[model samples]
Target: MHLKRFTDFALRVLIYLALHPGRTISINEIARAFDMSRNHLLKVINELVASEMIITYRGKTGGIRLARDPAAINVGALVRRLEGQAPLINCAEPLCPILPACTLKQVLNEAQHAFFEQLERYTLADLIGTKQEKLVNLLTNHVAGGNA
Candidate 1:
């Protein structure tokens, strides 16, 4: 199943924050790092903040940081939260003729459960394992070079 752009951005924000611990980072910095739209990034950041996945501060010295440890943020839970609890497929959305006996939706449901189950086995830290320095350097250089 395809993930929404918002979910993808949220994950990227979490990964970026995980890479640079102990310091607050700005939306502009993250936007530049990923060559993303600041406006879109702000929307993602706002949702993440509302969910308490990340914390924010106001004023000139303000920025954002993770609300908890990377290991505490389960990938599956984050995805499910971001993706919502809606069924993966809507068998009766258009009034399908087999709506009364549709198994396709149930099959899709099982597959979605399996997908999340696999994701639950990992955490944000798992996404940034053994190469934080490399990721940091890549992001820093990408920003420094003003590629976007």
Candidate 2:
């Protein structure tokens, strides 16, 4: 299943913060780094803050950073939070003739469950482990007016 753009951006934001660690990054900087709109990124940032995935600071010198260690942020949990409670399919309003007897929904549900189960096996730390140095270099270069 394809994740929405919002979820994709949310994940990107988390990874970006994970790469930076202690550094407080600005919304504008992130926007520029990812070539995304600041307005769109703000919405994602707000959600991330509310979900306690990241912390925000105010004032001129303020910015954003991860709220906890990367190892503590479960990818499955983050995906679930970002995706919310939306069902994979709207079987209640099914237009198909065999909707009532369909096993598609059940199969899809199982697949989705397995997908998340796999995600749960790894944390954000696991995501950036081998790529840490490369990610750091990319982020550093991106912030310094270079391509990521």
- lDDT at 78, model 1: 92
Worst 10 residues of 2 by lDDT: 139-148
Candidate 1 structure quality by residue, lDDT tens digits, 1-148: 8999999999999999999898899888888889889999999999999988999988998999999999999999999999987897777677889888878888998999999999999999999999899999988888788675
Spell out the clash pairs found in candidate 1: none
- Per-residue alpha-carbon lDDT of model 2 for 1-148, expressed as tens digits? 7887998998899998998889998888789788888899999999989989999999998999999999999999988878775668987774878887899988988888888888889898998989989987777777686543
Query: In model 2, where do residues sit more than 4 Å from their true spots?
Result: 141-148
Number of clashing pairs per prediction, in order: 0, 0
What TM-score does each of the candidates earn? 0.93, 0.90
**Number of the top-ranking candidate, with TM-score as the measure:** 1
